[model samples]
Structures are given as structure tokens and as C-alpha cells.
Target chain A: MKLKCIVIDDDIHAINGIKSYLNTLSNISLYKAYTDPLQALTDITGGANVDVIFMDVDMPMISGIELSKAIRHKTSKLIFTTSHSKYAYEAFEMNASAYLLKPYTFARFAETLNRLFPQSPSLPNISIQQEEDYFFVRNKNEKNSLIKVRYSDIVAVESLQNYVRIYTTNETIVTYIALSEIKIILQDYPNFAQAHRSFIIAKNHIEKVEGNTLKMVNNLTVNVGNSYREGIQEYIKEKTIRTSRS
Target chain B: MINIKKSPPFIRIQNWLAYKKFHIIIWLVFMLYESVIVGLFSGQFGNLINYILFYSLNISMFYVHTHIILESGLKRKNQIWWKLPVLLSLELLVYLMIYIGFDYLITDILKYFRPRKIGMTMQYILGPVYRAIYFMFFSTGYYFLLKFLSERKKTEELEHQRLNNMIQIARSENAFLKAQIQPHLLFNTLDFIYQNARDHSPIAAETILSLSEMMRYSVDSNKDKDFISLGEEINQVENLVNLHQLRKHHQLQIRFWYDDDIKKVEIIPLILITLVENIFKHGNLLSQSHPAEIKLYLQNNDLIIETSNQIAKVKEKPGFNSGIKNITKRLAYAYGDQSTFESGTTEDNYYKVRVTIKVKHTID
Candidate 1:
């Protein structure tokens, strides 16, 4: 389904900037852009069935926070595009799907979109083959070479656009395979778990769990998404040390 | 003008005494002298009671006239001139009547104890009335003298405060004047560049726009306000990061993360920006192995900010770490002992700054 998105920002320039960026994405369409928060609030409440919203935090009459509260139930996903880091906590409180700081690059914007619509149409050509405790992924650099990656040697899988960077014990390989495809191939492996929207990690490779971040054996720190946190916790629950006072 | 209510009782009493000490000392000395004279002249201990009654009445009348009557008159000094003589005459007549009534009552009571030597005559009544008039004149003079002296002291205090305020303003203005020129020039130049580059290069225009935004924030945010929304400061930090990234051609790896609910938090402006700027100024951000990281999160009620960067092998320019010093000073001024700021080079040679501010009361 084409994602119906709206942009609400006080700055016309910012709205235009976001519009230009939205033009490049094929799966998402900009439904409307509002410079006035009250008008946006009105339209949102007036039965505009929006799937996603890109909102600015600092608005004149009604803040993005208040507007989000007003239309939160109507929208499927809420993304906050702000210039300040201070609003991250507030955006989180509002259960924002993604937070993009101002002056963000196209790559960062694409990353947020991927997280919101992970199963979009562009991700169709991701194919993987598994054989006896190992997987073969088509390497993008070497057009026809299929790289062999052992399940035991895999440390993490980082998603970059339509490609996945497979970090192994011996070498790092960039393969032209989607993270979702890799997930399907490794679904039956009890040790491999999705740590973030853009990351898949081996449960045993995690050296330490520090707050929302997972420190891996090779010093790769992967963030744990709010949605995927439960699965990671449950995967490590049995292995966690417990002590009781007698 | 003075906040008497906020002062403790002891201090209030001391202030009262400081203003009225002269009048009180004079009254006490006169009372003592009068008692001695009356005892010596009368040569009879029985007359001491009359003197005591007369002195007590006189002192009480002086207090009532000076503190109540004169105080009110001085408070409305502009209007009191027209009513002064009439008010004084009415007060004197009341005093005379009170004295006469008290003298008759005291004499009648004394007759029960001793023989009455003094008789109820016109001379006797007139003499006390005359003495009451004289005491009124004396007390009124003392009251005016106190008013004049206190008024002078008040003016001197006001002048002192005004001078102190002027000096403070001058110091700030001096600092403002020193810092204003470069940013104004730089902002105009950036605007010119933005206008020129808009049609040719959108990226250059965007970079200039971001630079001007950062410059505007740095100039305007700290003008009169000590605190700004955390969101505003973060925006400037983003601009700083963006500008640096563009300068380095996207070679540097930088990551900024914060807790999701921290937008409503207030902090002294430019604090986080200063820390981030320090990284660009002194740290080796070009090394992708150790990407510069900035993280802001909440632990309980405290807002914690941590920034880490790898120490550069080659120093571009010598820095005394004045940015960190300024941040510490500002935090100390705003939060006092409620905030903690610590910065040092870690064991891995990474320069790190950790700031934890107690925000339980500040956050809504």
C-alpha cells in the first residue's frame, strides 16, 4: 500500500525541503503539508486518514506534542523532524516512530522510511539460500560471486538501503540482499535475533547489554529498538544471572 | 521600598532602633534630669510621685506624637503642609485635657495617702499646659531632624544601588560589543553566499542556511535569557555538526542520540553546543574507528549528557578547554550544587565530558 504521509512545519522552507526529499521516495506519497499547526490539527481531526506524519516540534499556536496527542489515534506512524535534540525524549513519550534532526542527509531520511515501512515494494529482489549451517548471499561488489557465511561465524547483519553488511569472524561482506530476506533465511536459527530495525545479531555474540545498546564481541554496538527489545530480552532471559538472598 | 516582612523580628527591632535611637536617648536623659531636679527642689519624697506621673505622661505623649502623628504626616508630606498647624493645635489641646484629667485623678488618689499641698487653680492648670506645649515643640523638632537624616540615608543607598547596576550593565555591554561585530559580518556574508548559491548549488545554499541559523541562535539565545528549551540548543548543535561534516566532506563519523522524552527540558543555552564544538576543535573526529558520540538520556530525574571523542595525534590549535569551563560556570550559576559536570581524558585516550543535571523540579 502507498503510505499516506503529511508534513506539518512552521517553516515553509523546511516543508519544501521535506517535500523535495519525499519526492524521491516511490512508496510514500505526501498527502498534504501544513505551515499552521491549528489548520493541521483541524484537517487531521476532519477525518483525514493519514498513515504517517512528519511534524515539527516547535510550532506557534499548538506544539507538535499537543497536535500529536490530538491525531495520534488516527495515524499509524508519527515521525518528528526537529532541529533540536532536546525534543527526543518528548517525541519518545509521544511514541513517535522515528525522530529526524534537522539538516539530516538523504540516507538518514531513507533509513527512517525503511524502519517505518520495512516491507515496502522496493525490497523484492532479496533472495538467500541456506545450506547445512551456512548461508550464501550474492555479493554486490563481485557481480556473480556468492559469498559463503557460516551461521557460527556471523556476528551481526547491518542493513544499508537494499543491501546488507554481513559481519563475520574473518571478513566483512557487503551483499545485495535485504535484511528481511536474511531474516527469513535465519528464522529457524534459535541463536539469531533481530536487535534493531537495521540490525540482526547473534544472541551469543553479545558481550554486554548496556541500557538500550548491545555491545558485541568485535566492539560493534547495536541499538535495540523499542519493538524488538522484548524479543532480545526474552532470548537472553534464561542466560541472565539471578541471585537471591537466603 | 524596604521589605520589612521578610526580615526577622530581631532585625526589625534593630532597624527601628537604628532610626529612632537619637530621639530615645534624648528622652531618657531628659527624664532622668527632670526627676533629679524635682526631688532636689521639693526636698520632700512625697512630691516624687507627682514628678513621676508628669514625666511618664510627657514621655508617652512624645512617643505618640512622634511615631504615629509625625510618621503619618511625613508619609504624606506633600499634603501635610496645609494641615500641619491645625493638626498640631488639635493634638496639643487633647494632650492638655488628658494631662488635666490625670492630674485631678492622681491628686485625689494622693489625698487618701497624704495631705494635699497643691490646690486646683488657674496657675496650676496653665503651668502644665504651657509645659505640654513646650514638649510638643521639642519633640516635633526632633522628629523632623530624624526624617531629614533618614531621607538622606535613603538617597545615598539608592545612589549606591544605581551605580552598581550601571557598572554591571556596562560590563555586559562591553562583552556584547566585543562579540557582536564578527558574527554580524559573518551572518551577512553567509546570507550573500546563500543568495548567490541558491540557483547554482542547492547543497551550498543549504549549508549556508544552516550556518546562519547556528550563528543566529548563538547571537540571540543568550541575549537576556539564561535558559532555553533543550530543543533549541539541540538544533544549534545539529547545525554545528552539519557545518563541520560539510567542512570535512562527510569523512567524519558522528552520532548524536538522546532519550525520546527530553524535548521539554530547559537548560542553559549553548552548553551542549560548546561540548560538541570542543570535539570539532580539539578531537580527532576524522578517525572512523572511534566515531565522536553524543548521548543525552534521563536516569531517574537527572538529565545526563555524555560526549566522547578520540584525542587527536596532531594538534591544530592550542585550546585551554575554555568551552568546558564556560559550560561548568553556566551550569553552576543556573543549577548551583544540584548539577554535576565532569570532564577528563579516559584510559583509552578518549576525551569525555559527562554532565548530569538534577531536573526533578525543573521538568513538568
Candidate 2:
């Protein structure tokens, strides 16, 4: 028997990312997806049952924290997905089964799912490419010399003083590589843009842009620097056209 | 009552001696001296020795009397007019009693030493009479000088107390006014932007513009001690609420009513802001089916602001981390007992607050 799963998130990019990661596992079946919590509540109370729910913390009409509480009496397992890492502790407080941060990788997603369902199907091997469309991350301790990542799967690359935090659809990888290096490597991607001094965000994940700051679908926002605003604006314009076509 | 843990033995004794009236030691000393030594003395000692003993006892009595009667334990105004003269006169009267007492001894001794001396009886009779007159003159002079000293001490204490009270009043008023004005304006601007985000993305931009304007003015004006018009405060509120109403998708209606007369009244820069901040922090209009209502006006020199809203029932304690409480403390400090503030939650979960302050212009 397959383990059925549901995702409740208002952000389209986050929902799609989760969907893409789910394709790797054979036994886990995607049951339903909800953007509006009110509609999702109706669907749940009206008899849509699932093994686990991947919930977001922040949303427009109804907050993820409130929704989790409202549905806690009915279900036992809830996996929280969020862009803001601040919500990770809050998820555990809500008694969630797992927490998946935004722009997470397939291997991290597989680990979380494996913990929940012991007999789950094995994920396929993912290879990294080294072209402008791909990025290489070297982990010294691991047997693998260079891990390849697809540019499209990346949501943002956050700078942490000495290192950069690369966020993909399913995994978050912290590399010793500088943000400037990563920015140069992924600069050609239509969705890639540097929104803050410490942040390079994927244009596709942007839900709302206010003033010089842009709020991503992962419920995270990055500021567009005065110096880099012109470049980001062009990237956002181009991505908007591409997304609209898709 | 008293905090015994903090009080030391010496302090307790000093406090008791200074404050407690009609100390038993003073009366006991008078009674014991008269009963024991005066009754027992037969004038065996010379006249100089007798005067020395009498003056020494009086000096000790005067020291205790000066500390108790003149120096008040309260550290404020004190009077010892009646005590100084009364204590001095009593000393002189004791001196006269002892002088007369010496006559009994002198007469007996004269019988032995100057049996044949002429007019001894006349000398004995005049001796006490002269001493009594001398004591009265000196007591009266000392009485006036002590009175002058005690009066000076009292005035100095009064001046110190008055200065301390004035400084406290000024500090509290300044704090209260800052509490009232700062946070209210801040949250109102926040509400405006939040509401604007609901209507149009561009409205959020506009909200930011207004917020920046308010913030810039606040930063500048906070540096100055000048009073601002109540009318200007109301105008700022109008702009904020109007902007908020635009962004609210739910038909959350906000009704505002205020006294036009108060518009001209000059108020401490931030008094109205505290109430507004309270309203916005607790008010949740998104979930409510009906619109929230707010009313503002001045009645009997007090600013009365009333606002009502139906918000989601928050499960946790709505804990007071806000600056409103500081403002309340400040208002009371600034206005003394002249201002009144009342707040409580209703059965419908609608929180209401009424704050009244007695308006008065600065004299200088």
C-alpha cells in the first residue's frame, strides 16, 4: 500500500517544488494540493483524508499556525514546509512530524519521508551538471568530489558571513563558496537575481514585490539593493514573461 | 508596618526619641534630680561648685531638648518655639530651687564658722533673690537666639522638599506625554500600510510615503520641547484611518466622531498617540463581519477616546508589553491627581478605555 500525502501552501513555487521532489519516490502518492486555507478546510471536513500534510506557517487569509491548531484534533502527522527557518522551532511546538525548509534538496526530502514511513521506495540517483545551467558543490568529508545541481531547482542563495546558503526546491546546502562566486555562476539563469547584499533569489519564487523588497513564495523576502535594482527588475520582467507562458 | 529588617538599633533609637512626644527621660531626669541630689544636698560644697553642677546638668538637658524639639525626624518643616523657652525656664527654675536649698546648708554651716558675724541673716535671705533674677534675664536671651536658629532650619528643609517635588513632577509629565504620542502614531501608520496592501499594491507604496512623512516629523519634533496642536493630531489620525479603510477587503466599518472644540486646544506633543496605538494593536478587522467603530472627543477637559472591535479570540494572555501603562504612570505623575484613566474588557470582548486629563497652560 502506498503512503498518501497532501500539501497546503499558498505559494505556487513552493507547491510545485514539493511536487517535483515527490516524483522521485515511487510508493508515496500525491493526493491533493491547497492554496486557500478556507477551501482546504472545506475539502478536509468534507472527507479528503491523507496520511500526512505538508503545511506552511504564513499565508494570506488564514495563518498556517492557526490552521495547524484547527486540524490538530483530526490528524496525527503534519510536515511543515516554510521558507523562513525561524518557523522550524515553531513547527516542533505544533507537534509536526517533519520540517522541510524552502529550496530544500531531494536527498533532504527523502530523509524526512524515510523517517516517517520506514518502507518507502528508494529515490533515484540525482547527477549534477557543470554548465552555466548547473552548479558544483564540493563536500571535503564526503566520498563524492563534486555534487551537481540544476539551476532551475534553486530558490535562493543566502550569504552567511563566510559561506553561502544555497536553497533548492528540496534541499538546503551550505557551501564555503562566496555569494559573489555563486552569483557569477548562476547569473545567466532567467530566474536568478540578487535581491539583497546577502541574498540572490530565484525570480520564479517571488509572490509580491514591495518598494525595494520582494516577498518570495516561501514566505521569505529579500531587499533589492539600490545598486542592483535595475538588474533584478529586468530579471523579474523576463521571469514573469516565462512563467506566464508556462 | 515598619520594615524592621532595614532599621538599625541607633536609627531606631534616634527616630523614636525625635518623633515620640513627651519623652519619659526628660521628665524622669527633672524628678530624679529634684528628689535625690537637691533634697539630699546640705550645701557642703562652695557656691562656685553648686553653680558648676547646676550649669552642667542644664547643658546636658539643653542638648537633648535641642535635638528633639528643633530637628524634626520628617526632614521637613519643624517648629520648636514653645519647647526652647519652656525648657530653658524650667532649667532656671531648678537653679532657683537649688539656690534656696543652699540656704538651709549655709545657715547651719555659719553657726559653726561665723557665729559672731553681724547681719548674716540678711545676706542669706538676699542670696537666692539675686540668683533668681540673674537666671530669668539669661534664659530670656537664650530663648530668642534658639528660636531664630530653629526657624532657619525649617525654611531650608521646606525649600529642599519643594525643589525635589518639582523635579519629579517634570520627569513624570515628560514620560507620560512621550508614551501618549509616540506608539499611537507609529501603529496608526502601520495599520494604514497594512490596509493599503489589501486594496492595491500601489496603495501600500502610498502608505509608506505617509508613514515616512509621519516618522520624519516625529524624529524632528521629539528633539524639541514645543507643544503641538490637538487639531494636527486629529488630522494625522484621519489620514491613517482613511488609508486603512481603503485596504480593508472585509466591510469592516470604522466610525469616528470627535469634538471640534478640542482641535484648537494645545496639548503635550504625544498624549493622543497612546490611545490610538492601543486600539490598533488589539483590533483585528479582517475576521470580523462588521466594521470596527472609534469615537474621540474632549469632555470636562479630558480626552475621551472610545473604540470597539470583534477580534479572533486569542487563547494566550494578551500580556501588557505595550507603552500605554508607562503613559498612564506619567500622566498621573505630570498631572498629580488631576487626570483620570479607566479601561476594561466588555462581555462582547470589546475593550473600552476612557482617559481624562485636566488641561492647563504652562505659566512660563
Candidate 3:
């Protein structure tokens, strides 16, 4: 079962960052979003379908904690996404599924998602072992070390020299694997998309769309290449339309 | 927690007994003097008048003598041997004149009174002269004895104070030595863990666990004293050495030795560790082509630790810095006159340091 999530925050960049990262995790399906917590509360309480809400603690009309408590009778799971560790204890008290600290990497994002959606017997332990859906790879320099990166943990792949540097939530692992091979392997995953020739960003990680360009959760801008711009635009417009319909 | 009322009974009883004896003797002598003087000076009206004058003279003399003695900073022997002779001679001359004048008055005013019958007048000259000498000796002796007892008491108090000061200094030094050891141990162990952590070696987690264990042991065990048993301290050092030895490709040659008996004895905690650190700090800078030798040994109830490394040859020679001088100061403070430290370059281009500290049996 997928986690039906929503982004309720005032800061566009933060909301975008969370949206981009959530795109990479197939299990975390974004349902509805609102810039204002009051409006988001009205929509959620007024019969919106949301299982888990990724709420920001700092909001203008109502705080994420306050909104979560207000909608406690409605939603099942509430995950707090903020930059402060001070609110972590408070978030847990509110029965939050997870508290995602800001400036988090893709690996940390995946780890949080794995906790939110617990594994059943049928779903193999892809975190501990590589399944047919994903594969773990690292550079020759990191292969023998403890710095190995799994495909599920890779937020983006950047082509550098004869190596493709795989950026994870924890650290980056650069390997001699061809970018074509990465693109081919990750093509089937809903979260992975070749936004540019040099970059294959996790589609779930798309934070904002300005015309043809896409900003990632890390505030890094990836050009929506002429070929992939149409597909990227369609995916974002469809998400907005679906949320409005819901 | 502190039992203040538990002072030994013997000390309290001794103090009370001494105080009672001192006051009792003073009161007895005062009463005896008053009785003897009152009897000798009361006979007739003429005698009574004469007695009043004699009594006044004695009182004046007593006041003057006591004032001089109490205010004088002179030693008891000087007051007895010199001041008494001068003061008595001066008082005697005045008394002699008074006596001669009184004799003339008795002869002129009392013509009916026989010279033989005037016993009070006859006894005045001889009695006063003899009494004057006797009183001076008595007072001076008493004053000197009290001064001697007070001086002895003060000397004992000062000795006790000196011993207490020494103990406080030893305790503080022990504390400083402990601080020095713990920080240095922490630095080296953290550095070892960091080396593994930076490489992202799978063993980094194990190194962290080992590092935590070492830290827990250091904080828990080294709370009381600056030094631990030689065997225990060496084990900590060995753990650090083993970390480097595990990465043997560095080809670092480390030799450690200590007497089997010395293992039970305790030495300053960080002394040997500092020597090891200095060896690594200097040896790592040396040409890798040349082998480094660090030798630590115990002999003759003294910790003899030495580390030698080939100096990195460069035209711009570095001067002596604070780290070595600091160790020297710490050693001096820890052992005082009981430690010897030497550092220099050998003719064979090897820089060496030799530190020797006498082992002390620490009370567990």
C-alpha cells in the first residue's frame, strides 16, 4: 500500500524540495498540497483523501504541529518535515510517522519512507539486499569500502568524465558505470527520469517547474531538455489537476 | 557525611588538663604574694603610715617592670640577663636615697623614740634592698619560662601547618597530572578512529565501539588519581599501538618494554603516552626511506622511556617549541627532584628523548 501524502507549508522552496524528494520514493504518493495551513486544514477536514501528511512546523496561519493536531481526527499518519532538530521530540509526541530534518539527502529520504511503509513478506528487503527492481553500485574506489550506494538510494546521477557519480542521501558514490546503463536500469521506476543528458533525477524529487526547467529538492536546477520537457510538464500538470480534483 | 564530633577523646582531655594546670598555678602564686605582703606591713599607726609608703613603692615598681616586659620585643634570655641588671640598679639608687632621708626624719621628729626601738625604720634599708633583688629574679624567671613555652608551642603549630600545605600541593599535582593524561589519551584514540572513519572502512564502526570503550574506561577509572597501574596504562597504550600495527603497510617499527615487576607499580598516567605521541609526531615527518625506532623500557625501579627518529633533513631547521618544554614543566611539577628528562640529536642523525621517573606505590 502507498502512503497518500500532502505538502502543507508556506515556503515554496521547502515545499518544492519535499515534493521533489517524495517523487523518488514510489511508495510515497503525493495526494494534495496547500501553501496555507488553514486552507490545507479546510481541504483535509473537508474530505480530502490523505493517509500521511508531510507538514512544515513553521506556517503563518497555523503551525504544522497545530494543523496536525487539528486534523488528528481525520488523517492516520503525519510526518513533520523541518530544518530544526529542536522540534523533533515534539513531533514524535504528536504521533508523527517520521521527522525528516531539512538539508537531508536522498538516502535519508529513502530510509524515512521505508520506515513509513513497513515491509511485508511478499516485498523483499531491498534495503538490505538488491532485488530485481533495484541494484546497488559504487565506484571502484568505494566498492571495497563502506560507501556503497544502492539504486533506490540514488536521488540523481551526474555524468563526470568516464564515471557517473551517483548522489545518495548520505554520500555520493562515483563509478565507471555508463550513464546509458543507469538510465536503462532506472527507466522503469516511476521516480527516475532523464531530465537532462548529464542528469537522471528521481521524478518524485521534482520540487518546482518554471517553464521547461526543474528545481530539485536540493535547490539544484536541472534543465528540462527539449526532448524530456514535454513529459516533465505533463507529469507536473497532471499532479496539480489530480490534487484539485481530489 | 563528615563526623565533626568524632575527634579523638584523648586530644580533648589533654587540652582541658593543660588549660586547668596553667590557670591554677597563676591563681595560687597571686594569693601567696598578697598574704605575705599584708602581714609584714601592718604593726602600728607609725608602722601603718610607713607601710602605705612601702606598698605604693612596690606597686609602682611592679607596674613599670610588667609594662617594659610586655611591650619589649627582646628575647627572654636578653630580658633576664641584661634588662633586669639595668632596671634593678636604677631602682636601687632611688630606694637608697629614700631610706637615708627617712632615717634622718626619724632622728629629728621623734627624739623620744630610741634608735634601737625604731625597728621598722632600721629594717627598711636592709629589707628593701634584699627584697628588691629577690623580686627582680622571681619575676624575670617567671616571664622567661612562659616565653619559652609559648615559643615551643608556636614552633609545633608551624610544623603542622607546613605538613598540611605539602599535602595540599601533592593532591593538586596529582589532579593536574590526571588532566594531562586523560586529554592526551583522548586525542590519540580519537585520531585513530578518525583515520578509519575518513576512509569509510567497514571497521570504522568497530573502531568507534573500541573508542567508546576506551573513553568509558578512562573516565571511570582515572577519577581518583593521576597515575594507574603500569600494566593497565600500558594496555591502553597497546590498544593505540595495535591500531597502527593493524595498518602495517606504514612499516612503523615500534618497540615497547617494561619490567615484569614494574607492571604492578604506578607511574604518571600520560608520561609514557606523551613520549609515544612525540615519537609519532616527529617520526612521521622523517624520510620514509629510513626506519623509525621507538623504545620504551623499565629498569631499576624507574620508567626509562625513549623514542628515536631520523630528523627530517631540510636547510630551514625548526627550533625547539613549547610541547617539549611543557612536558618538562609537567614532569618537574609531578615528581619534583625525582625525575630526569633528556632530549637531543645523536651523531647518527637520530633525534631522541629519554625520560626517567621513579615509580611510586599508589595507595589503591
Best by TM-score: 1
The 10-residue segment of model 3 chain B with minimum total lDDT is B1-10
| Counted clashes in each candidate structure | 10, 12, 10
lDDT of each: 0.73, 0.59, 0.60
lDDT of 1 by residue, B232-290 (tens): 87778767776765555444656676544576788777788788888887788766458
lDDT, residue B145, candidate 1: 60
Query: Model 3: what is its DockQ?
Result: 0.01
Q: Per-residue lDDT of B1-364 in model 3, one digit per residue for the tens? A: 1112222244443453379774345434443455455455553233444545454555445544544643352547656667656666766777566655554565566442523433446565676677555454544544565566678899999999999999999999999778656553554345345333533553453345345435545654645576677767665665555455333321344444333444676776776666666666555432423545444455687777677777656442343446678778878998997889999988988888888888777344
Question: Candidate 1 regions off by >4 Å?
Answer: A1-23, A26-205, A208-213, A222-229, A238-246, B1-223, B246-257, B286-291, B360-364
In CAPRI terms, model 2 is classed as incorrect
Task: Give the residue spans of candidate 2 off by over 4 A.
Answer: A1-246, B1-98, B106-122, B155-237, B242-284, B287-310, B316-364
iRMSD for each candidate structure, in the order shown: 8.4, 22.4, 21.7
Model 2 chain A worst lDDT window (10 residues)? A83-92
lDDT of 1 at A196: 73
TM-score of chain B of each: 0.47, 0.40, 0.39
